[model samples]
Target: MPFQNTMGDYQTRQTLETFGFLPALTQEEIFDQIAYVIAQGWTPSIEHIHPSQAMNHYWPMWKLPFFGSVDLQQVVNELEACHRAYPDHHVRFTGYDNYTQSQGSAFVVFEGRR
Candidate 1:
């Protein structure tokens, strides 16, 4: 029998979260995504977690979901505030759809030190 490479040896490192595997989104792009979420009537929320524990635990919500919020700038402000407070933590933005009662969209907005 000839020696052959098998799939079992492959290993992947845990990444930040959704959108983490892809190139970081630009500020404008992030804004656009938030806008879309709001347009869909999804409430926006921010969460943060230390990079080391990102995959092991649930991130704590920054404050609370911005219910009834249509101001894009307000959401951005909260995101910025969370980043400032947790400079070494990964910050994520999520949209909660009331009708579905689940997260409709989510993405990492700021990446912490790995």
Candidate 2:
């Protein structure tokens, strides 16, 4: 109900906050969103989204290894495009590091007020 209260106030924007979960996003749906980033010819990884800030934080998202098959910068560019598309929306590419190559469910983030 809390999110409903805040989210209801800005219905469409709230929808943007979601990880493309409307219309009942199945695995394919999640993959579809991920594919949006991947289609740019980069391996999309969960390098940035955070759990607390994500609607799909607790979703059944998982990560797998890419094993010498990845293009980080391309993913970065793709995500950058996504960011450009959603300027006002709160999104973060939250948690990727040297050890992990970001292979998890795509989750949007609500960033701090700039």
Candidate 3:
């Protein structure tokens, strides 16, 4: 079956991917994307990576993965907390599927302060 597109009116995967590197995302934008992911029943996670070590390092999992949040605000709250802590590093929002046990989709919502 073909993939069902969600995040209506939001940027398409192709568009989002255009940012091979993280694009500048406002706090509102991040929250908007978070809201969309939560509505889809996907788990949200934050990843951090340094620009200098982009070649030698991997996207380190910063915090514990969020699974099945009952409240959308909770997920946004967690993301905000993570961003404040790592304000100068690269951070991206990734949503995972609980059933297939695979990454459902991912997007670099923000690329911390350059």
Per-residue CA lDDT of model 1 for 1-114, tens digit only, reads 112244442235344555655556889999999999999999999999998888855789999899989999999999999999999998899999999998899998987887
| Clashing residue pairs found in predicted model 1 | none
- lDDT top scorer: 1
Distance (Å) between predicted and true CA of 107, model 1? 0.5
Question: What is the Cα-based TM-score of model 3?
Answer: 0.64
What are the lDDT figures for the candidates, one per model? 0.85, 0.41, 0.64
Tens-digit lDDT track of model 2 for 1-114: 123334545464434333433443444544455555444443344333333444554332224323333455544454465455545444443223324544334355333233
- Considering only N, C-alpha and C atoms within 3 Å, which residue pairs clash in candidate 3? none
**What is residue 94's positional error in candidate 2, in angstroms?**
6.0
* Tens digits of per-residue lDDT for model 3, 1-114: 123356652344223332343445567776777777778888888776654543343588767888777576776676567677877766667888887887676666545554
Rank order by TM-score, top first?
A: 1, 3, 2
By summed lDDT, the worst window of 10 consecutive residues in model 1 runs over 1-10
Worst 10 residues of 3 by lDDT: 13-22
TM-score of each: 0.85, 0.29, 0.64
RMSD of each: 6.9, 12.6, 8.8
